[model samples]
Target: MKKVVVTGVGIVSPLGIGKQANWDGVTSGRSGIGPISLFEPDEGLITKFAGEIPEFDATHWLSKPEARRYDRFLHVALAAGLEAVEDSGLVIDDSNAQRVATILGVGLGGMPFLEETIGQRIATRKLRRVSPFFIPGLIANMAPGLLSIYTGARGESWTATSACASANHAIGASLRALRSGACDVALTGGAEAVVCHTTIAGFNAMKALSTRNDDPATASRPFDSGRDGFVLGEGAAVLVLETEEHAQARGATVYAEVAGFGATADAHHITAPRPDGDGAVQAMSMALQDGGLAREQVGYINAHGTSTPANDKMETAAIRTLFGDHAERLAVSSTKSMTGHLLGAAAAVEAVFSVMALQQGILPPTINQFASDPECDLDYIPHQARKAEVEVALSNSLGFGGTNAAVAFRSAR
Candidate 1:
């Protein structure tokens, strides 16, 4: 199998825009969660805070006409995708366009679009009230389709939707495609901008969001004793992937090598993880086995610590079950503590942080750890960042429907 390496990464998260800003914000233990500004939360809504991108304006990233044609999710995806291609210095001309692929992961493609269209339809009480771009703008596949059109990459373009595990599944598929000689370069990641009314109301109905309206910054306290639930976030991130040989030929700077990927299903529950964490345990183990990576070689883990009672506890159990004694020594941290939960885009953003950790030899901190939970005991690197040289790292993402996926990375230095 050909070795796949990450040449460039682009990110626009609650923390900040681009890689450097996000790296600085996360490593400094800053929290990006704040009060919900996108929409007015009614009195009945339990959660009012979220990790919203305050400075994001779609017109700044896309042309006025293009911005009006697509949804916010597509705008963010194209922003990150263009940045990744520029950062990687990978030219996709007529000769090499067929060997490049564009794949993105999106959970709820355009919830705001649907909500707006429905509102207009109801207000006008007319079938022809909806815009013609309604169907094309809101579909999940259009994210990758627009990205391919913008970047001129003609190999394969599609979107992967697996709820919160969507990004990891897309990345895993890209790795397999590259190894199988299907594409020489892949523009892959995840994007989501569903912090609108309907999405928020839906998660609120499930009681899956935090209600710490008094202190929004500290609401997403993953692994904390006082944690209530995850704080929803919105963001997008893209990684430019190329085989080791291809990257070296182009003189591209390699950030890290994507060593392996593993995916599994619990077949247990729709919204809750299995109590035994059987799916998560097997997923991590398979990532190691697939990469031929020894258990002890993994020094850091970007955990899927959702700040929810069920997820944090189950993920901790899964780690202990898989690594046993080695789990104690691993520097486990959750960037979600600061970025809130980016849903489908969470794994892609975490993957970028994992690569930055390997490159800079510094572990990003999981902030707001005032009180510790006994069941979630681990070296979370709380309160502040830790400087350490890690040779290998893994990023885990567990979603609803008992779907779990993990991707392992090896430091290129």
Candidate 2:
């Protein structure tokens, strides 16, 4: 198999608009959660808080005409993809552009747009009232499709949806394609912008959202006894993955090696994780085997700690089962506590955090963990960042469909 390395990364999250800004916020233990400002929630909505990307100017990333055609989700994806491509510093001309692919994950694709169109149709009662670009803007695959079109990348382009694990699946699939000689370079990541009435109502009805509207920052407290549920967030994160030979040939600065990827289905429940965390353990074990790494070599873990009771405890159990003696020595943190839950984009953003940890030797903190629970008895790096020499890092992402994925990364020495 070909050696895969991350040459560049991009992020558009609630903390900030760019990669460095987001990293600084995560490392500094800042919280981005606040009351929802996109739409009023007084109209019978249970949850009224979200982690919205503040001060975002769509015109900065998209042309006025282009912005009209695409939805907000596509705009985020395109902006992040462009940032990743620019960071890679790879001069992809017409001759080499065909070798670059785009694979992005999106969970709720254009839900806001769908709702808007439906409302318009009901009010006007005209079939021709819908915008011509509505269908293209609402498709899940259009996230990557827009990237390919903008960058002139003619290689394989598609979107993967595995609930919250969508981005990890997309990144792992891109690495496999590159290793199989299908593509030399790829842009992979995830995006989600579904903080609207319909989605919020559904999540609220299911009791899956945090209702701490008074104190938004303290709402997402992962591993804490007072934890309630996750705060809905919207953002996108993208990465540039290239073959080691390809990156070296271009003298690109490699961040870290995409050592391994493991995926499994719980086959047990639709929303809840397996009671014993069997799927998570299996996924972590497979990732270690795939990376040819020992359990002790993993210095840090970016956990899927979704600030929920079941997920936090189950993920902790899974780690203890997989790592055994090494579990206590690992530095684990949940960036979600700071960035809120970006749903499909969670794994992609955390993957960027893992790579950055290995490169900068700084572990981001799992903020908002005031009172630790006995079940989640691990080094969560609570409330503050830590400086550690990390050689290898693992990121875990679990989704609602009982889908789990673990990705391993090694420092580019």
Candidate 3:
């Protein structure tokens, strides 16, 4: 089997744009959640905050006319994908373009775009006023489609829409393809731009969002006793993956090894997690088993602590059940404390953070941990970063419809 390794990473996070900015923000425990700047929230909207990128112009990556053709998700997808290719320094010419795959995960697609075209524009004007780019920009697959077109990767291109686990599934699929010789290289990740009025309204209606409008920065206090719920966020991330042999043959800089991937369905709830955390335990165990790593081998876990009442406790119980005493030793954290919840893009962004942790030998802190919940007790590396020699790291993502996914990363060095 071909060993899967990461060569490059690009991020479009609220922490900042690009890889280094996100690294600095997360490692320093900076919170990006604040009042929504993407659009004016309804006066009576319960949740008024989100992790939105301020002053982002899609024309920076796409031409003016091209930018008008696609939705925000595709815009960020192209930007992040291009940045990853440049960071990897991989030349995708006529010969190797066919050997490169592009798989991007997107959960919401162009909901905002569709809503605007149908609800607002069409309602105010005639159907003829609608732009012709509506369908192409409104589809979820266009994130990968536009990214592939930009990168010239013609191999096995598609998108994953597995709710929040979309990116993990996309990454896992690319690893499988690489191991099976289906592709020599893969550009895979996720993009989400659902911080619009409709998304915020919907999540608020379901009580899945935090209503801490008074204190936006501290709203995403994962595992904290006074936590309310996750804050909606928008971002995109792309990882350049290639076989170990291929990467070495071309002298590419290796970031980390994609040791194992585990994805499972909870089959229990649509939006809530099972209290027993059985599916999460299975996913984490499968990742360890697939990587031939014992529970003690994993030094850090980028937890899916959504700051919700159910998820944090469930994830804590799952870790304890699977790792025994090692769970106590693990530096578990939720970067959602800073970036809010990026929905489908959460796994991809957290995967990059896990790889960064292994490479830097540092664990990013989960800030706003002033208080703790008894059911969610663990070494959360709270409020501050910690210096640790991390060898193996686990990134977990649990999504709606009981979807659970875990990906294990091993230090390249």
Q: What is the lDDT of residue 385 in candidate 2?
A: 98
Q: Candidate 1: where are CA atoms >4 Å away?
A: none
Expressed as tens digits, the lDDT of each residue in 1-413 for candidate 1 is: 79999999999989988888899999999999998888787787778889987698888777898798788888888888888888888888999999999888898899988887666687778775578898999999998899899889999999889888999999999999999999999999999998887888899899999989999999999999999999999899999999899999989999999999999999999999999999999999988888889989999999999999999999999999999999989999999999989888899999999999999999999899999899999999998999999999999999998999999999999
TM-score of each: 0.98, 0.98, 0.98
Q: Count the backbone clashes (under 3 Å) in each candidate.
A: 0, 0, 0
When summed lDDT is taken over every stretch of 10 residues in candidate 1, the lowest stretch is 120-129
| Candidate 2 residue runs with Cα over 4 Å from true position | 123-128
The weakest ten consecutive residues by lDDT in model 2 span 115-124
Q: After superposition, how far is residue 188 of candidate 3 from its true place, in Å?
A: 0.8
RMSD of candidates 1 onward, in order: 1.0, 1.1, 1.1
Error of 2 at 305 (Å): 0.5
